[model samples]
Target chain A: MTDRLPHPLRSDALDNRERILDAARALFATEGLNVPMREIARHAGVGPATLYRRFPTKQMLATEAFADEMRACHVLVEEGLAEPDPWRGFCLVIEKTCELHARSRGFTEAFMSTFPEAMDFAAERAYALRSIAELANRAKDAGHLRPDFVLDDLILMLMANRGIHTISKTARVAASRRFAALVIQAFRASPQHSPLPPVARLSPAAPGKVM
Target chain B: MTDRLPHPLRSDALDNRERILDAARALFATEGLNVPMREIARHAGVGPATLYRRFPTKQMLATEAFADEMRACHVLVEEGLAEPDPWRGFCLVIEKTCELHARSRGFTEAFMSTFPEAMDFAAERAYALRSIAELANRAKDAGHLRPDFVLDDLILMLMANRGIHTISKTARVAASRRFAALVIQAFRASPQHSPLPPVARLSPAAPGKVM
Candidate 1:
């Protein structure tokens, strides 16, 4: 496997590809996906000709850039899980999720605009969430969390806090942290803490007219 | 106020309007909203002229149908709240929501296709949810439920559980019940029960991809 590794030429090409993606992420973050290919190439320290030779299309470059950000998120969660304390581990994981969501909000909105159903990305997401949920459950069973908590509810609720990204950066972090801590407290194994009020029933607006 | 009650003629007209809406709901459920005005009038035991007078246009008719169903859901939750147990009340409310969702799925899809956002509907929905959440919180405070729970989490998770609908009705109900119980257990202020797995992260797919 070592002997079959890329020679100097292939290694140089690989480095250029990485650089292009880096440049695309920065550009996409700043100027967005429609930014000129020439600009991206310039930012990457490569000529437009070299950029096309690598990605062949702007969509390819943008996709790669977006995927790189997602890959970084996966790495962040992995690192979070490496923490010795499961409570700390889970907190770090959720916090990392909020950070990534803030950065990729534009990408997410854009992606879903074209794919209305969102099932394509939903597949991979479902798998990852299920895995993490299992881990959270294990921690709960081990007495790290309150027993009545389920991972599925927390995941959707946290992600559904889409309002968090719209907040100011400093406030965003504070809000995200508050949201995480609140959910965590709700997961406690004991009823030492107070819960929120119960939900009310919706009234029918002249409901007798249910045609 | 009693002396100022509507004249008999006005009362008769109001009854006719309600009759028309009922016919519209049935027709929309069976044949959908594209059905001719004559057909709806026929179903309502009135003439096309009457439906037009009551509804004004197709959009108004559709909105009325949608609002009618939502109002019915509101009633179900309200009635459920009178139940002796808070858990039962929550379950009853969710069950009604699922039933309404099953019926309104087509109507909502058609409506949203023409108008991308339903800000009014969403706001009303959030308002209704806030009420339900408050009730759940009350139950928790009363030591009737686990302390670690969020109402938004439960609602979102239920919405996400579309798969359960594909199964047999009995099975679907059972699954929903179990799902609710699991959430309730997770919210239980105890250490013996286990927390559910981690929340699922949605995959932000590339646009133009649904599956």
Candidate 2:
């Protein structure tokens, strides 16, 4: 078939597309969505015309860049749902989600920001929230989750988790782990005396300190 | 005695200084510390020369702008220290501090950012930490706070609280209150199920929805 033909031009176009995406993801992850298109093109070693030809708008580039993370986010929700124990599943989802966000500042911003044009992104977010809400109801029925817990509480937790910043990605994740433990404890139906994860060295007093 | 003399020029300079500080505080609270010097002057109804004469640099302006908040912060710590119950004291400090920071985004940024020339700010911060550490120790001794609770956990909570964004100052404060309650529950040595403050409507799903 023509579609399966080994065409040199098509292969090169595919390679350029991949390179541009890679650069966009890296820059956005580090410097956030404000990084200019020209900088992304330079980083990808592609011409301005080629970059524009592939992704005409910054929003398009951002939506494409975060596509993988969004998919991973859905998989996380699925994994939680697959768990037999609803409470444990909920905790797992919170822990994993916080860690995922901690690894990429850009993803957190994108997830929280209202992008009117990104319908798919919004729909995916709504789907994930619904799944979590269902899981929460199960946990509440089992009397393992706090009765007062609301779906908006999860949003509050995510927003709070987004505030964590450290000198290194590793440290941010560590801090997030401890934070997740605290949050899980708060959300539990009963106060279980569990040892928290080790503290991450996020003190601003000791500037330049890494975890 | 000469300092008390009511010279017209001195009174006018004092009025200008007050206006500049007020404008700086308002702008910094809403827009952050990045607002330009000329803009601040314009907001204060002062000339560029007068603003520069009053505050030679942005750092100096920021320092002066936040002086009142710094004092208020110290008062909060002192009030907490004076409370009979160490746990209650700790919780009060957390709740009030978070509310204070929530009202002003710029103050949070300034508190977290290290300014080399702002020695007073650093010293006050260190003092506040030491006082909180002393309070935590008391709480631990009294068997009220979790044994594993560290000073850094407070920092973690503050950073997380800083992440909350709402449509209005009232909503932000409400969200911070709820977040503080959650953190307090997490920090408690015993799991006592108390009702949380009413949840603030901070969901991004319903964009433009105010609390």
Which structure among the candidates has the greatest lDDT?
2
Which ten contiguous residues of candidate 1 chain B have the minimum total lDDT? B202-211
| Model 2 chain A poorest ten-residue lDDT run | A202-211
- Please give me the DockQ of candidate 2 compared with the native complex: 0.22
Model 1 error, position A205 (Å): 36
Give the distance in Å from residue A144's predicted Cα in candidate 2 to where it truly belongs. Answer: 1.5
Residue-by-residue lDDT tens digits, candidate 2, A92-166: 899899988888887877776555454357678889989999999999999988777777778878878877743
CAPRI class assigned to model 1: incorrect
What stretches of model 1 exceed 4 Å from their correct place? A1-62, A106-141, A145-211, B1-62, B86-91, B94-141, B145-211
Candidate 1 on B21-62: residue-level lDDT in tens? Answer: 787777665454557878888988998888898778765676
Residues B110-139, candidate 2, lDDT per residue (tens digit)? 775455444357677778889999999999
Per-model TM-score, in order, reads: 0.46, 0.83
